[model samples]
Target: MNYKLIVVMLFLVMGALVEGKRLANLGHKLKQEAEKVGKEAGHILEGKVAQKAADVVFNAVLRKG
Candidate 1:
């Protein structure tokens, strides 16, 4: 009886460890995807800001002339 109980406990612990590793891997993947999306968004916003600044400068030059 004691031997059976020990085996059962070992299986439970092993299962728990496997599940924990899976969750950690999932969390890491999600973080990488989020970083990728953020970088893409940053590039898009940077382009728009540059265009707006150029337009502002062009308009100012036209007014001065």
Candidate 2:
């Protein structure tokens, strides 16, 4: 009976370890994807800001002329 209990405990520990590893891997993948998306969003925002700045400058120049 003691040996059976030990075997059961071992299996449970191994299963838990495997599950933990899987969750860690999934978290890593999600983080990478979020970073990629963040970079793309940053680039898009930068472009928009630049365009708006240019428009403001162009309008200012036209008004002066």
Q: In candidate 1, what are the lDDT values of residues 1-65, reduced to their tens digit?
A: 69999999999999999999999999999999999999999999999999999999999999999
Model 2 alpha-carbon drift over 4 Å, by segment: none
Q: Please give the CA lDDT of all the candidate structures.
A: 0.99, 0.99
Error of 2 at 9 (Å): 0.6
CA displacement after TM-score superposition, residue 42 of candidate 1 (Å): 0.9
Encode model 2's per-residue lDDT on 1-65: one tens digit a residue: 69999999999999999999999999999999999999999999999999999999999999999
The TM-score of candidate 1 is: 0.86
- TM-score for all predictions? 0.86, 0.93
**Which consecutive 10 residues in model 1 have the weakest lDDT in total?**
1-10
